[model samples]
Target chain A: MSDDWSAEVEELRLRRRDAMALGGAEAVAKHHERGRLTIRERVTRLVDTDSFKEVGTLTGQGRYDGATLKGVTPAPYVMGLASIDGRPVAVGGEDFTIRGGSSWSGDRKKGGQGGFIEDLAASYRIPLVNLIDGSGGSVTSINKRGHSIFPGVHGFERSVELLGKVPVVSAVLGTAAGGPAGRAILSHWSVMVDGTSHVFAAGPPVVERSLGQKIGKEDLGGTQIAVDLAGTIDNRVDSEEACFAELRRFLSYMPSNVWEAPPEVACTDPVDRCDEELLSTVPKDRRKPYNMRKLIGHIVDNGSVFEIQPTYGKALITCLARMNGKVVGIVANNPMVYGGAMDVKAARKQIHFVEMCDCFHIPLIFLVDVPGFMVGRDAEAAATLRDGMRAVYVGLQATVPTYTVVIRKCYGMAGMGTTEKNGLEFKIAWPSAEWGSLPIEGGVAAAFRRELANAPDAKAREREIEAELRAMASPFRTAEAFGVEEIVDPRETRPYLCRFIDAAQARIRTSLGPKAKYGVRP
Target chain B: MAAIQVKADVAGSVWQITTKVGQKIEAGETIMIIESMKMEIPVIAEQDGTIDKFMVDEKTAISEGQVLAVLTR
Candidate 1:
């Protein structure tokens, strides 16, 4: 009995030692202070309630300096497989208390679990969710620049390569700066907690030393800057709890990847249930902006619009939505972002989303208010034209049943392609919808720049030009040229687009080809 | 002087002409902007060129491999 008791005491002592080594009280205190959940907490939230199968929970070191405690387990991150909503998914999260979740495998010894988890994800064809947080290769610790920088332990590049095979999703729950942020960048979809999470190539300390800018952490990688300015990330959430909710919403519709179609949900909204408000939801003026998203929500099946790359392209909003219980791709514009200006970034986003939906044989319901392409010197530097043109090429080449409804401002490239090719398919436009080579304001600026500038009465002449262009930009004007198929009442948009999707879905198998390829990003 | 094929990044129809046939242009000069999605996309010259070969005329459709122009220095 004494011998058995001693062994039990020793095991308990080692477990206590392991926890202490990973930062022990310090890490717990820090987690509480920041209102951030621990790695275990995050993993539970990601997987179905109590469905997580943790592989290496007791692997972190509890030593002060290193996990060299002979008998202690050494791991900085938790790696395992869990089923989200009953489908298997591979997930990983950093234990920040353990040396700030630094990656120091020292030649694959400490970081082998991450590799094992990735292999399971790739082999199983399940979705991979990386609740990634922390930096790579700790320089300050270890006998010689520490364990995180060792060879054969880097797991990021492989993740990027394996993106298309399986649906990869990431949520930046904390300050996921540096190498960790790159993982999130390569995902099919990524969400960031606005106040809790930040993504950047480096932290403020590095920036302060390198650029001589002592910026705050928020400035370094805030949600607004990443979501709004850079246009690199997808969505920004109000809190960590909301981030998980967004993740559930995204994973609900998508399967693993292109190999499997989005899971069908039992939708209750009537297939013919039409929202008549769409008729007047858009502004008549080509230069004015309106809420295209609201109209999309009302038309799609109840709570069915799953917008991908929502933050990347404001000019074009691409989503996988459902109508009458059938999945469809929604490509619309958020005029709030760039006056619905389709730029290079928007082009990349639109083309990728279009290609994915096409491969999956999903019908496309393109909500058009696209104000052509972005303009001026800045647009030139961005190669906006290059990207936008590629989008046009993809849209034309796509074989899915494309139904377009011209909401309000469907001028330029957006106007022509948003509808079926010269009325090749069903295209309905509202009376308020306008189509032209350019917005009258921009057209007058370019064709008669000097004339408009030199006019004796500039403002009044501008108004007159606006009126003339408004007359020229009407949907009636476009329909007269056989550009638009039929001009319908705006209130009937939901019913019209729904019928078009039904027509398109029945004809998917006949048009499958290499052109119908999958992409890792949208 | 060597020539590089200035291929369009995407397939689209050429719409606006921003350069002349015989213009001595520096690298990254706007050759012509293609119109797609109601947006004007400019095909910039990567190197200096005399616009020696204007393969695509304005309002003409060009695919990805259908060269827009060739730059010869």
Candidate 2:
């Protein structure tokens, strides 16, 4: 045999060059013309510089002239290990330039739905970032496999398990349907770029055939339907670069895995940096709604708040923020939307946010101003009461330390959910806080109905009873009786909650690991 | 020119119309105030635009997402 093995080595170099081409120049140019990034470019943009340790690069279909290989076409998916923010992550995405990034099966599966990427995240207990672009499970697969395959052969069992153990993030970078769309929903947090991305159960072709209605892809499952209306996607960004930035920001708040506590950073915003405007933030006239977002900005660590599902539930605001450098979840009621009442949508939003915070062992800060569960025929028809109660049920079951700050109105079962009744049962209030079973204005009308109906001046007598009840409903009286734990000025909210959150880290660290939730929600 | 549909954020009755048709309005300026659940919620213009038309008059009952006005930027 010849001592030189240069021929085989040269063949290997050519094969690697074919894989680097990534579906060739023309197809990649088409993808770029559509305002989307290729999988290779996306991976480069998302991960730390030169940190991608790519696996399965040599997987492709080879064309040979009697054992002398001409070239190879790479697989439609690319995946491997990478680091984000100097922390390890299993990153992968579908190569859309290759046959619209459809499923490509090699000798062994690579990633996307119960594959090596998910397995890597599970075994190593690190975060998994999925850049989903493929339209999953084409009918062409049946011709190749020579049979109509059963559903979920490459199932989501691993994806489901990863949600419980590690932080799973998905980004829909293209028009995703079927299996790919389902995978996007399995993440702890998911995002899609506006205009360039869309996700749905089926694309417009399937929808038109099933329903006999022609519709555009954007109309069916763009950010409006996916993020704002349905809340199927958690966040939407203007571009892919912004999407990547937000993904990094989201992971910064999360622990690498549930077994570890959420990472905290040093705080430059002082604990005692109380804004004087906090005192006048809530208006003296309660009917005139004030800016709750402005109020939140005044309290938390400066520039540390990241809102989740901001447009979907207009009544409630859920944010991941820092308090004295410790990561905290803020669930504040918006006074501008139905007086911050807990409607069906707001209830669903609360349940998800509360459960996520509890799972990650992040303490909660509830800035309450809810009057009660929403009222009206529309609310009743929508089963708002049931959903509202389920939110309360989930809140009661949460073991994380919750610091309730009653800013203004707190009434009924919706109000009761804000307190950490299961744990400390401690609640603090602002001097402006007022609490009761129901607001006295309406309660008096129902309780003293017949009395007021028979009075010489029913409206005047009703006002008198309301006045009497309002005097007794003062927060000071509640504090005097120890009904509430403490009453502080609005400016003291940051320092007060920060001190308690720092102290409760000891309790939070002890309870790390998967939280096994029990009982069916009401 | 782009026509923007300014929708109601809540189901409520229009309390007051703060702008007129054919008038210029800045982004973040209140176009109308809605009375809902004993609170006044302002319907704001999200972009700087000239008022195209009022979709609903003051005191009209409107549902969430009902167009309150049209603006041409």
Candidate 3:
């Protein structure tokens, strides 16, 4: 009976040490040599110091030797509740060293950690962050478990629920194929390391076996393919540290949950700060291209613009920024790309971005400079009109306060999608704005083609007609006719935006309720 | 020498050929202009190279992601 509890305590400590080793020293060394961090190291970097409280640390397949316990090595996936930037969040990721983070054979807890973290985040009403890196479902586990069973509902359902309830973020640290890749796309904000990470439905070997295609891992699902070509992920960073930093910056703009308003900070930039360069940023010549990003930089609070999907929809720019200490989403036309015309990709990008802002209670600011929807056979083949209509539908259904500034040529259906059909809080236009069913150059060619063809001097007649129509398309005419709300000086854009943000903040304070009747689609 | 393919990002009619074949060009130089939606969009080279040849003639319609030109660096 002497010191009976000492031996039991020593055994518990020894098992804990084995569980922490995580696939032994050699596997971890390989992970570090490849410029990757361990799962615990990543979690430590993501959360506040000493703030992680693990929920399932000692859960794994237990081993025994004739009734005397040998040990229980933990599962490859780790999850816990943690504080990020002083706010509570549920964080989890795969320990790739342990059998490539494969599912355990005959283990009921297989595919359980993701759902557990999702449930924890939903119940706590906190944001969820997933650091994914694995081989997805284990193919070899079927050999040991006899057979694999397909559940009626999977972790995706929980992920969808978490989307509507809180902000969900995912980071692909390494090879994330199949289910893990899907989780990366399902997130509200996602990032991948440039050289070290790859995401796809199947890795190269699988693709080669199934389709007889010889492709490398990077070629199959590299940063260029995912971020630039497909636009599946939000941003690509150079290192894991940068990925975590981006996640923190993204969460700072949104509320902890959908029920609350977005957090506001003390803005150092003056609301009345005006940049004189804005007056000339939009070229007087309609055919010339001007930088929209420079104008956005001047309008928002200094150093506050965080652009999303920058490479996907080159024509349209959608970003998050702070206006007088309040978070607002900005959607602008990039004249440098396709002359700021709305194409199929731009339409889809705008639709998804508008819905995200509306769901998260962020006010919208639209800088309009659209020539119209892309036209011709290619546009028809891409179904640009259908997607353009969807963009219009989402724009109309958005409940958040919208402020639209018409900087230049706003023509046709594409121009109409920049604001709510019924009304908006502030629908101001700059002096350079022009609006119509179509640009006179194209319209004259269509409507009065026969007239010009019949004239003695066809070229001269066409030029005269275009000049007359162009003069009448001025934005001042719309203002005098009580069509447009007001025509403001370009330098006053910041002041107008700040005024709208103040109004939106006041309105949001009165109505902090559920965002919509449905959840956001991936 | 490495061959770089320049593709059109939008569908449009070739408005003009801004560069001649075998011309030495720098990165970001306009290779050609395509007219779509009544606007002329300049297709720029992504790398410093010599224009190998034009894939589409002037006034011809081109689709998005179509290879417009080949360059050898």
Candidate 4:
């Protein structure tokens, strides 16, 4: 009986070895040559050292001859529970070396294992980090297995359930087309390696065949296309290590689940440390472009601003930062781009960013300098108004505390979207701030065009009208009319923002509960 | 080296031209300023280069992605 038990143990060891080999030594070497880490290697690097406890190591495709194994066993997917920064998390990745990481032969086993991991994370309320590198579903499987069954709402239902419940992150390390791409986007935050990763609904071959146009894989779904142009993913890092670092930073600002509040660190930077330079940061001459980034640095906690999509939406700046040691989302208008007007792209960017912040229960700080939504035939063609309306709708729906600071130009519908009309808790403005239905320079021409055209000196009359409108548009008048709550000095911004955070901290804590209604939309 | 085209990122009217043809300019030096959406955006040189030519004159309306100048590195 002892000899029989030893032989059975030996067989189990051989099966485990085969499953661990992935596609084989040569295939793994090829994968390395292309500058990609294996599935196990990625998971090891992502999690805390020696903290990973794998869930399914011996489950894979197997072949046998009367109880004796004859071929290599392939798991194709690896999953486990691990600790990241001493906090528990569930992680999984596709073994791309096996059948190109396609869901072909062992999908039933893969789905069972994947579902188990999701369930484990959901039950324990831990973050889920997926490192996806697959060829999505395989066409060859159809020929070999005589077609597959289609179930409505099967793959993404688990992800949807985990959306408002816990944080989900995905790192696209290699080509992630079709279903894998969908998973990457479904996560709350996603990062892709610059050159090695690509994501798309369909690869170039499928597009060429269907649309009769030739295109490269990089052009179709490279980091630049997916992140900068399409805004499909949150970030694009130079390497896998950078991607992991970004994930760690992003998760730091979020709770393990919505059941908890974001962790707070001790405040090191003095809340009242105001820079006198902020007084002159926004030029008195509204036409001059001053750096808003510099102003943001002086207001938030020192070195705590982490900008998101800095390149895509030039006019609207969106970032995550710490105000008085509490995580907050910052949205400011960049005067360097279109005079900080909300263009179609900028509107879409703000709408998406606001939705993400609202879903995570992060309070928002709006530093408005919007002149108005972009105006012209080009803006009309871009459907700027449609996107602008969406931005306003999302801005109003936000349940988190919203603090608005009208730093400069705040006019037209774009200004209205900066804060709710029902009086925000901290809707204050600076001396440089000015708000109106429209800018005097552009509005004067349209409103008194006929009068100017008929005047003895059309140019002089135009100038006179503009001067009168400018005086009426002063921030003082808005205060006198009770339209603006208060106008503080520029130097008071830091202290005010810090005070708002301190005052709202208790409210944020009390607001923590089940986020059953606000599941994030992909 | 290839000639780099300095492009306007937003639709606007050129307010001023800061650099002249044949003038050596450093990377990120403003070549021209465009007034749009009630603010001025500077079109900067991408690399250290000599200005080859101006593509648009002051007060000329240029569309987004339109080339404002050519610079030869």
Candidate 5:
């Protein structure tokens, strides 16, 4: 009986060793050199260390002969449960070594690797993190083994259905294109491994054939272009290590799913610590532009903001950050970029960011410097109002803790809520706040143009009217009407926001039905 | 040269008309203003053209994407 027990123990040990040998450090290192992380490594990094519990471990390629083979096949993608910041999460990581990390046979596998990952995240009610590093779904497998697999729009529909159920994160660690690109986009937050990768719906060859444009991958859909000009992708990084690290950081502010608030962690940046410098950060002169990004740094947890679409919609700043080590989405109107005016492109960019954060249960932080929406013929030519107002519409529908700070001017129809919608929470303002149907300078000319024209000193008269309007625009005047929430000191911003978020950390609602779905958009 | 219509992107009132009819202009040149929020948005010419027609007088209320002026290149 003792000998039988010993034999069973030895066999169990061998099985454990075989599991560990699936892809060891050497495989990880090889993928790292290729600007990618191994599936196991990515799963480990995305979730907490020693947290991931993988599924579908033995699924792989079939052999030609009846004889069995041990090292013949490897599951290219790792999927299953894990704890992110101590909360249960699901992860899908691509193993580049398996046919260079493309699910060469995912088409025949029926769900496509991306589909399986999406299903796991949805069924389990856990946030999904995709560590993509491949040349899309293996085309050779699909082209060669045609009748066995099917791919279509359903792939995208599955992801969209899973959107509001939980926070979806994507880390592009290697060349992601075609099907992989589709997977990467299903995230509220996405970051790319800079030197090692790129993403696009189609390759340059496809574009050249279809659109008659000869462009390289770097110029057309590199990380910088995607993050800056297109507003399609969210974040960009320098290496695979950074990409994995970013996945950990992004999950910090978002809950495991929409049913919960972001997990609380010990915060090193004390909430009470105030930066007095923020008081003087904005210059007294309204014409002069100052760095609003600086103000963002001062307010959130130290070095916690992972700014998305950093280059696109420069007038509006969107980022994911931690307040008291709990993830929050921060969107600020930047005076530096077109005086923080919401433009057609900016509007489109912000709406997507807002929806993403709200869907993921991240508390929203809005710094309203909106002098108004961008107006004029150029704006109209670009369908400015329609695109710009879309953000406001989306904002009104959000069921998250929204904190709006009136750093400066809030003007016109865009600023004043329409007939139906309610306003933001903690509607605080600065002392220099000013809002109206329009700026007084422009209004004065329209209302009393004859007086200005008749006066010998037209310039002087105009200046005087501007001065009076500026005075009326003060926060004290707004407070008298109870239009402003509170005139807060710049230093008090951190403490106030932190406390508000803490108190308002309620379970978020995800209204999507029991099954997955998606919407059609250009 | 024929005219091209450059429309307002956001709804607001015309703050000013920077260029008159027949003024030669280039792409991205601000020709008029629309005040929204509290700031004045300069309406720029989308293409290189000569100002052929003024769509609205100064201080006139406008909707977003409304044609503000016609330009001829």
Candidate 6:
């Protein structure tokens, strides 16, 4: 007898086919009918073609008839190693077709909090991409297990550790609640598809049962709430295809890991490509608002500006762009929104961007046009001061080289945050730039309050003081005093910034690795 | 014709009404100038349209997201 292993090998092939079927054809068809891609489809489309090498494919509950095995039902999680844009990354997602992608207890987890995929990313020091589409733990698990597991049984220790070591990206592909939703938030940057995806602590039924307030899923946790209003998710797109493209675009600027420098592409746009419109980008009329987005487009490399939190913080523009083919974080204030005041939302946005850039050793460029922290009773009630201070606090702690270009109005503590005070303290400005403890218009009124009140023409007296201070506030005067490093022609902004950003690469290279922050934020 | 409502992005008073009712305005044309935080913020038409009506007059106090005008495209 030739002890042939052909029958056992055939059984292995059949079990693999069952895993590939994924909750049977009926469930997969239902998933597709909803205009959503299956977990397998999502993984294939996101990574480079022919790049996915899946792990844990054979893990599932097995059925046996006496000594012969019948079939296997694959676990609700799929993950493995893959490459994005030629660099290796660990990617994973929940298989929503099986039991609504609830938490599956295998001998070991494939993906989720502390999953094996996370371990792969941490060990290899590569980026981790999580395509989240799960409802997480269910009450029915208790009946199957005979006891309920503790909350931290599958803790986020690995998720949190991966943030400081590698770039972690999360995409909410479908309705996410409980553990999966919490896992999505732990990523360094996260995105969600509009109309099809929703993420929250709990779903509508749970909210209604607990709070006595009935709400639809979309209304409770749609892109409007998660991305726009709350700033929980960083970006949103029209379709899943666009979401995949965005994810690829974002990782292009980031390094594979914090231990390395951010990838730089060849520059086709000339470093000295000076645009004449930059001279007049800021309106001569102080009260008039021009398009900051257009201004940013002109300065950065052609078609290289990817805005982060574009909808959430209208007052501030935060983007990852290339200067001289080198990656840079642009933090520019929007003059159109409340005169570019640092409101609570804008402050929160600034803090996150600064920290992320610092973590990856990316240089920062500040295009300052902020008036100050937002004013009025509403601003105070919203904790604008605390948040604004926290923004400044992070800015101070950031060790990365920062270049400050005062475009127009830079005033108060918000203005102070833009400069690299602890490091090089390099600042360049345009002719229109003005900075002080406060704007001259508001300062004159307060400083000479009694003097103006006593004067027969209070309005005239106030105007006289404002005019005198405004003349002294010219950027040229500051340059003459060497208070600001230099004042350049507005048209020279691109060439000048490119030169400095290129020069700062040496400093950035030497400072590569994980950044350790100290002190408590206000 | 489809009527589109234009809302204020910031809370302030109407400084000046730059467009009139029934005026044919192109996209990005200033509908009005709002004075908030001592800055003149222009409320521009998002699409090419004719001004149907002005919901708030010059110097009228307005809140954020308040409908400032309606335009028929």
Tell me the lDDT of model 1 at A158. Answer: 58
* Cα lDDT, model 4, residue A334: 90
- Pairs clashing in candidate 2? none
Candidate 3 residues A190-276, lDDT tens each?
Answer: 899999999999999899999999999889898989887888787899999999898889989989988899999999999998899
**Candidate 3 i-RMS:** 1.8
Q: What is the lDDT of residue A431 in candidate 4?
A: 87
DockQ of each: 0.02, 0.79, 0.41, 0.80, 0.07, 0.78
| lDDT, each prediction | 0.70, 0.91, 0.85, 0.83, 0.72, 0.92
Q: Could you estimate the TM-score for every candidate?
A: 0.72, 0.97, 0.90, 0.93, 0.75, 0.97
Question: Per-residue lDDT of A1-522 in model 4, one digit per residue for the tens?
Answer: 354687778877897788788899999999999999999999888888998998777777678889768866576778889989989998888888987786533434443124667787788999999898987776666677696757422467777778768888889999998877888887778889999999999999999999998999899999889888788877889998888888888888888887788778778999989899987888777788888898999899998888887767788899999988999999999998888999998998898778777767788889999989988888899899989978987787677888899998888888877885433645789988877888888888889989988999988999998998888778888888787888889898889878877888787788875544443432
Q: lDDT per residue, candidate 1, B1-73, as tens digits?
A: 7776787644557878788766889885778877644445556676876877778788897754467787677
**lDDT tens readout by residue for model 3, B1-72:** 898999987777899999999999999799998886556778888889999988999999887789999999
Per-residue lDDT of model 1, residues A15-64, tens digit only: 75664354566777888689787877787876798888866545653444
Residue A102 displacement (Å), model 4 = 1.5
When 1 and 3 are scored with TM-score, the better candidate is 3
Candidate 4 global TM-score? 0.93
* Model 2: fnat (fraction of native contacts): 0.68
Model 1 gets an lDDT of: 0.70
- Candidate 4 docking band: medium
Q: What are the chain A TM-scores for all the models, listed individually?
A: 0.80, 0.97, 0.95, 0.94, 0.83, 0.98
lDDT of 2 by residue, A1-522 (tens): 898989988988898898889989999999999999999899999999999999888888999999778899998889999999999999999999888888878777788887888989999999999999999888998888899988988999999988778999999999889889999999888999999999999999999999998999999999999999888999999999999999999999999999999999999999998899999988888788888999999999999999999998889999999999999999999998988999888998998899889888889999999999989999999899999999999899998899999999999999978888779977999999999898887689899999999999999999999888888889999999999999998898889888999999999889999989799887
Clash counts for the predictions, in order? 14, 0, 0, 0, 14, 0
Q: What are the iRMS values of all candidates?
A: 7.7, 0.8, 1.8, 1.0, 4.6, 0.7
